[model samples]
Target: MPSLTLADLDQRPELAPAVLALFAAAPPGAHHLVCGLPAAMGQEPTAEILARTSGMLLALSGRQVAGAIGICPYSEDQVTLWGPATAQAAVAEFLFTSTREALHLSRFGSMRALIDTRNREQRAFYRAHGFAAWKDNHLYECVLETRTSTGTVSRGSLAFKVRAATTRDHNAVISILTRAFPDSDHCLPSLAKREADGYRHYVLEEAGTVVAAAAVQDAGRRGWLKLIAVKPELRGRQLSRRLLEGVLASESRRGKRTMALEVLADNAPAIALYEHAGFRRKWTATIMTGPV
Candidate 1:
């Protein structure tokens, strides 16, 4: 008889393969398991770095992994869930029960998931589980596919050159981030663990001074674009378009079919730029909070 079970990923390292399979089976543009699993599948999950070292679990039908759930701390009282994928009712219920218990154990007051709106089944599942839309997250993809004749490269009215970043450029990248996003809402592994981080990093410099930067990390078959920021004073020069093109072109050449990133609901200008570049809306991930 196949009995439902729940276990931490560390307990069943072999389940990584099955877990990756579940992610691949989702909608074309669905965000794969963002934690535990490799940025790209077929590779091993980063055991030491997933889920902020808190609540992470795998659902099982006897010995076979059926699904998984992860809780990344968003604040002292809040957590961000990664999965609860396209799973069966009983499977999801078990995962949710395990998740809630894990949260209570960890003392977190609220929990939320950034769900993809395009995946109707998953969206319906979240709603059924009492998750609500506290806000909207726009996920866009395909940097190269969206290229227009208008030229994706930034001519750099200020005379800037784009190139791969090195350790020496780290502080500059941080400086630009501080100035451009004083209340930073986005987080990247590079910022958290650059030493072991695998994401390819790039930077745009004007007269030898780093002014803009972007990053791309492999997510199994696709690539995820991280933070792309420009100095406030240089925003009008289309530096963003150039930096994105430079990053996307590099990744596309590597044979990655698509690239993706997320922006908050109110960031219309950034969404417009991505749309102009040929990137389409893959889905909207809702960050549901409180009891659900």
Candidate 2:
């Protein structure tokens, strides 16, 4: 097999499909974030977009590909790998070799990949490649098989009203998030696209202002809690928990059986809230960072 080249991704508009297939073939819950743009955007990724977005994906004669990295905004220091796969040893050799070559010239400081929690082989592969486990950054999952008996009534001392967010709620949500997670940049695009895709948002209103908010994206039998943020001044009031419960309750009622979310390992408060609310650790993914 020839060395993987940037020209391959440019030629394959079905790159997203191929990657998705790889994920499915691996095991359940193998990756937290998809490597490609959301299908809802109808964005056919271009070579320029790939190179600009993170690093370029290299491919070899349609049999092998590698050296793909996705820069995540949640963790600016890390990159996610989406490498080549083939049954041919030559193909694997080409992919590994190209990956090493790309690493030498890559601008990123760190790179990592999420292997399935149950797939020991894949996890070992990652370890052999020099990636270590980031024990603190664990993924959580909650099954909605049965709705929690918890009522939708707001539980906090803060006087707030829960309502569906409207067009008027965007700026307020953005402001709240900016204040809550000063370093995070993952949600903006997804939030913007929610408006375009017609996803419903839940907001907590206090004194006629949206203080806490969360967005829900329909994912078949599962519902994704995309963004959950609260104002800084209201930190210890449990407003975020109330808002999350309200959203989860509504999603459960709508036949969404699972709620999934990702949080930084160091965010103790947020992780505590999720645990208290019945979310359990499912897996962990590392964010590797180097230079650019």
Candidate 3:
């Protein structure tokens, strides 16, 4: 390996091209907006943008960028990263840890990562570098053209009234999520945030009480399922599947070509339900936290 040097992106904006070249080789969904594309000789991302954004540092083999690491915001007080995948573990560790310290994450909060679950190499790198797998998220996409609508889908015995979540259902929805995903760092979107983010939610009411809820957001030509939860005590009613079907119907009717959602890979019941509903596995995301 060639001798490598690290530099703050804020100072050496000229290296953006080399860093982006490294990023382009990683799997899809590695970075966004900036896409970390190699900058034209005189066309680097402005210093103002780099300064206001999360801390980012680049790893260079001499003058050519080899690897880079930086924070990408995920939620309030939480962040993630966008960097090269082929770099050595030592280089990754130094850039990531240094960026974390530079941001004073301990005072603000640890930056988080939504890593691809199937990429075992990435997972191992995260583990070796002190990142804990906070959540195991599996991505699934529903092909709208081939699925049954809510009107045609039938349910037996486990009957529940499915309807759009109302403002009054906010408290009940939050309670269900707290019980369903205890201690998990998943992005439990608040009802206010939901509306602000253009998310629509549906709730499953068993005898007029909210037992399960799920939300999906408008993602241009595609639909993005944001959150779903069922009460802890009610386990085998298949309520989640039911609500998902209902949401899918609405999503399809709105002319969405497809819908996507993420669930914990270990949650076999949810996995089975999604699979049965024709939501095939698209990818798996491993939620990783900042270096310790």
Candidate 4:
């Protein structure tokens, strides 16, 4: 193995395009690929995501970029790994270990990597490095065709009433999300930040109370379904499907050509709902985590 030197992306901003190129060439199951991001088809969305990563480290064999990794801090104690992409197999472990050491110097207490299930090499690499399998996540995409309108969709006698969530609905939305995704980090603070970054939350109402809600990230031609949750007691009423349709309708109205989302592989009901809504499974991944 050749000796490698590490460089922080912040100190070497000019190497960004090189890093982007590396990620762009690697597909969902590629050994050098990054995981846990939306849109497996294009580079723009991925680039935008990498641009927001908290820290990135590059492994250099002399002056050439040999490997790289991106870290995104989602919570006070946890960070998500975007990559440990390497140009050669020999430098992979070196890159991953170096990145982990750097993360230990930060406030993060643990790190996670979401790798495509087909990437057995990458999966084994993480496992050998002390990471354990957490959960399986399936990526789904829905392609939209040009349509004048999304007709009045309803279930039974009652019509599903959907609208953009407002400041007044903050508490109600938080309550639902808290119960629906207790382990998720996308709560109040993340919600506010995502909203500020142009992410939209759509809600469904029954009588006067909010029953279901979804968070969407509009990326010009593409949209991402960050989350969708329904009031626990009100589930099984088809409110989830109705709310989903309304969300797709909104994306169609905005002229977005595609929409994507990630759901737990074991979530049969949610998978069935998305499949029924025209979303197709594109990739499956296993989320692995370990102490930093």
Candidate 5:
């Protein structure tokens, strides 16, 4: 085997293309995994998204980029690992160990990696490194069709409207998201920053009050449904379906060709709702976490 060398991508900016190719050339059961970002099959990470990472560690073997890893800080206490993307299995551990050493991993409380369920080798590798399988997440997507109209729906004398949220709706949307995902870093104080990053929030309003909400991250022809929630008091009312319909309608109007999202494998209600809406599970991943 050739001797491997590691370099910080920022310092060796010229190696960017090879690092990207390492990710693009990923094969089944060894795909490059990025967290806190939307990446569908055939989708390549954009420069803007790469720029969000705190570090990119590249492994080289005689001028060839053999492996790479991108570190994205998710919060003060957690960071998401993008990859130990390597040309051969022999380099996976070297890439991961070098990354931990290069980035001084101890500052974070934990690290996470989301790997395709089929990647049994990678799963076992992480386990050997002290990571535990947290849960399975299913990635679902549906082709979208243009719609001419959408309006309030009525069910048993109750009517609700679904539409893109306005500035005035920010508080309500954030409140619902905060309540729904209390531990999430995507809500509250970060909402404005996220909106600036092209996330759009939609709401289902009943009598002028936002009853259900969803946040979408638009990527040209596709939208990633990041989070969706209904006000707790109205869960039995099927408001989630209504809000989802509205979101689809809105996305269609914006020229989106598809919508994708990830849901917990155990979330039966959410799975059924997406399935009923024509979304099909494309893949499953195990979210593994380990102390840093």
Candidate 6:
């Protein structure tokens, strides 16, 4: 068992491939959102994304690579490990070493691995390694294959104007998200980057003001729906649904096959809206936190 090293990820592209292979075998409607990187040479950016945000490491068992994990600095004493898993103890040992290397690279505090709810075995492994349950999240997947539009609701019926977001609409988009979900720490930064990444933002305007908004990130055959928020003053009028439907129809027109998103498990209203609009439960992810 060799110590895990950053060089491993650079040297062995198979590690990511193996992870993707495993994720592809996941249950139907289950989204391996964590492994959303390309399984090719270009995957270096995915690795770099983790390394730059936190730090990354790869674990190897002899000539056969085992697994990999990435850690990012969050708060002063907290580090977030995005993807961490290894089937072999030697590989696990390497994972631990590689994480330490990430800490050295970032000069940050301690680290914890973010695990998915479906990977109970991996979760147990992390617990055995002294990681505790820190945060819980639900992964919802709409069965795009089963989606049948109940016919588009009239925009006039909802009294909301739904339209595609343009660069000119950036300020309004940001304003809606900030006002609708003021405490959603994860979504705010993502909203900022969507514009930067060239994804189109969509808004639902009411009385000349943006009341709800969402963004679509094109993932070839699949599209990611994110930054969904409705203004506080305009909650019950189905504004969010209109915005979501508008985005979905636009994606459908573009020939995208699937649309996916993650929502808080406690948000029943949101879950209902998604269900009503043809989205179904896919999987769940837990956000584990620990002291740095």
Best by lDDT: 5
lDDT of each: 0.65, 0.58, 0.65, 0.78, 0.79, 0.59
What RMSD value applies to candidate 2? 6.1
In model 6, which runs have C-alpha deviations exceeding 4 angstroms? 1-6, 11-56, 70-83, 104-112, 143-159, 183-193, 196-198
Each prediction's RMSD to truth? 5.1, 6.1, 6.7, 2.4, 2.2, 5.2
Expressed as tens digits, the lDDT of each residue in 79-177 for candidate 6 is: 666455455666666666556655676656566554557666666666766667756655554535544443245454445566787666777777777
Q: CA shift at 11, candidate 2, in angstroms?
A: 3.0
User: Candidate 2 residues 108-224, lDDT tens each?
Assistant: 566665444554554555566677776435567787766664434533564557677777787887778677767766455766685666466888887567879887766456566
Tens-place lDDT per residue, model 1, 14-61, is 666666556555534554333322232212344434433355678888
- Model 4 lDDT at residue 245: 84
Residues 146-194 of candidate 3: C-alpha lDDT, one tens digit per residue = 6556623335654567678888998887777667767643335577775
Instruction: Give the C-alpha miss distance for residue 192 in model 4, angstroms.
Output: 4.2
lDDT of 3 at 255: 89
Sorted by lDDT, highest first, which candidate order results? 5, 4, 1, 3, 6, 2
Candidate 2 — which residues are off by over 4 angstroms?
A: 1-22, 28-79, 84-93, 96-112, 115-136, 148-159, 186-193, 197-200
Better candidate number, 5 or 6, judged by lDDT: 5
Q: Residue 151 in candidate 1 has what lDDT?
A: 18
Error of 3 at 53 (Å): 8.0
Per residue, candidate 4 scores C-alpha lDDT tens digits across 64-153 of: 788788777667788888778775766777788887777778888898888877778888888898999999988888887743435345
- Per-residue lDDT for 1-292 in model 5, tens only? 7898888888888888777777766643455353444443335665655666888888788888888888877777888787787757668888888766755746777888888888777788889989999999898988888554485677666678998888888889889999988998787466677899889988999877798899999776788898999988888667798888888888888889899898999998889889987899878888899877
lDDT of 4 at 34: 50
TM-score of each: 0.72, 0.66, 0.69, 0.90, 0.91, 0.74
Q: How much is 235 displaced in model 6, in angstroms? A: 1.1
Which scores greater on lDDT, model 4 or model 6?
4
Candidate 4 off by > 4 Å: 30-32, 36-47, 146-157, 190-192
